[model samples]
Target: MRPLPHHRTLRPDRRPELTLSQPLETLAFTPWPGIGNDIWETVAFPNEGYSYEVWTSVTRDPEATGGLRGGVTVRQGEAIIARLTCDPDTPSQSLDVIYDLKESIGQCWDFTSRSWQTSCG
Candidate 1:
């Protein structure tokens, strides 16, 4: 995979004050190639105050029998607030279009902690 861009800046005019109660549009979506019979996808939502990412995995591998496996990560500014795993029976969002905005601030996903954090670390 290519390295994620390190340089990004938020536009002054696009700064929005948002809350969980308000309707939000998808900000980014990333899909990973299937391994064996397992497929994975991740979707991001960016808000002014807090942002969130949901990752889902679907497996048809008979060796590892399972339903859907996924979780949600919530962030406030540069700090991670929560990481929650969904039940295997739960459903995830389905998206058709994929686009990324380079004008917005960027963060890194820390696999060790399973959360998003500032890239400097």
Candidate 2:
């Protein structure tokens, strides 16, 4: 696997964000190579305070086999955060995700420059 770029700083123009802590909860993940598609789910902690995001992963690989690994995090609503792709030769996938929501700047920013997402990441 290649080394992906790390986003240490938050986006100024994106949107307001929540101070979600690390180690989010894992909900569910299903991957199928035999079916020619991999299913992935995780709650998204959007920049807009807090919200939910559920998405799917498509492998589009004919020789792929096994299941994808991912998780769901829940705070108030639900969302998917992390996901794993199937290995090229091997057949396995894992991920870090969540399922939930907590909206509003009060819920998001902690009403301070020092926020959960700010100091943690």
Candidate 3:
């Protein structure tokens, strides 16, 4: 685990946002299963030592991927860190999404990688 820098999540008494200390590129969502079709959800970037509180709302309509998606903004100071993108041609909501959630999002939903490894849980 990388040593996290000065960090603090501000649960504001009056605000509608969640904040993190670093850019989340590597993530593992808690229903570590399937996700992709356009659902806005959160991912944990452990390397960053913080959980990215993300979200997504359907835009226009819903398709196989639903529709255009509207979501959160991962920013640093005033610059945009990562913008939530809504891709309509994907299976965004499912029960098998395991990703890195960084600039390169990984989907382990199709049983591609060996999931279970050691004899420790």
Candidate 4:
């Protein structure tokens, strides 16, 4: 995995209204393993009343680039305000630390079926 950048930038076409230029060190990063060989990475930024979470899932296959299949979710308290899928060639950061946050919260990706499952079977 690549090192996290000092700052993260979003594609202009992805969400013109939403811009991320702050240093990533201030954000929270979480990494967790999926059902089989897949892994989920999430970076969250908290705002005044809401938070923005960027998530991506990748397989153990070294050739697979998972950035093409993730999205950004905006949430306020426990409610999801919006969800925007990422476009091709979007930029995402990978951090060195792993928090296993998703799995602890009961979220996992089923590698065989290539879908998300509440629990790994």
Best TM-score goes to which candidate? Answer: 4
After superposing candidate 2, which stretches have Cα over 4 Å from the reference? 1-16, 22-36, 44-50, 54-121
- Per-residue lDDT of model 1, residues 1-121, tens digit only: 2333343344688855444432223245554543456677677777768778778777667677677787767778877777777666566443322322311335444456654444635
Q: Rank the candidates by TM-score, best first.
A: 4, 1, 3, 2
Which candidate leads in lDDT? Answer: 4
Model 3 earns a TM-score of 0.25
RMSD of 4: 11.6
lDDT of 4 by residue, 66-108 (tens): 4435777788887887777656545454432334444565656
Q: Compared with the true structure, what per-residue lDDT tens digits does model 2 show for residues 57-115?
A: 54556676533433233333343333333333332333322212222111232324323
Clashes of each: 0, 23, 16, 0
User: Candidate 1: where is the Cα deviation over 4 Å?
Assistant: 1-26, 34-38, 92-121
Better of 2 and 4 by TM-score: 4
Which regions of candidate 3 are displaced past 4 Å?
A: 1-40, 46-73, 77-80, 94-121
Model 4: residues with Cα > 4 Å off, grouped in runs:
1-15, 21-25, 33-37, 61-68, 88-121
What lDDT is reached at residue 49 by model 3?
36
- How does each model score on TM-score? 0.47, 0.23, 0.25, 0.49
lDDT of the structure predicted as candidate 1: 0.57
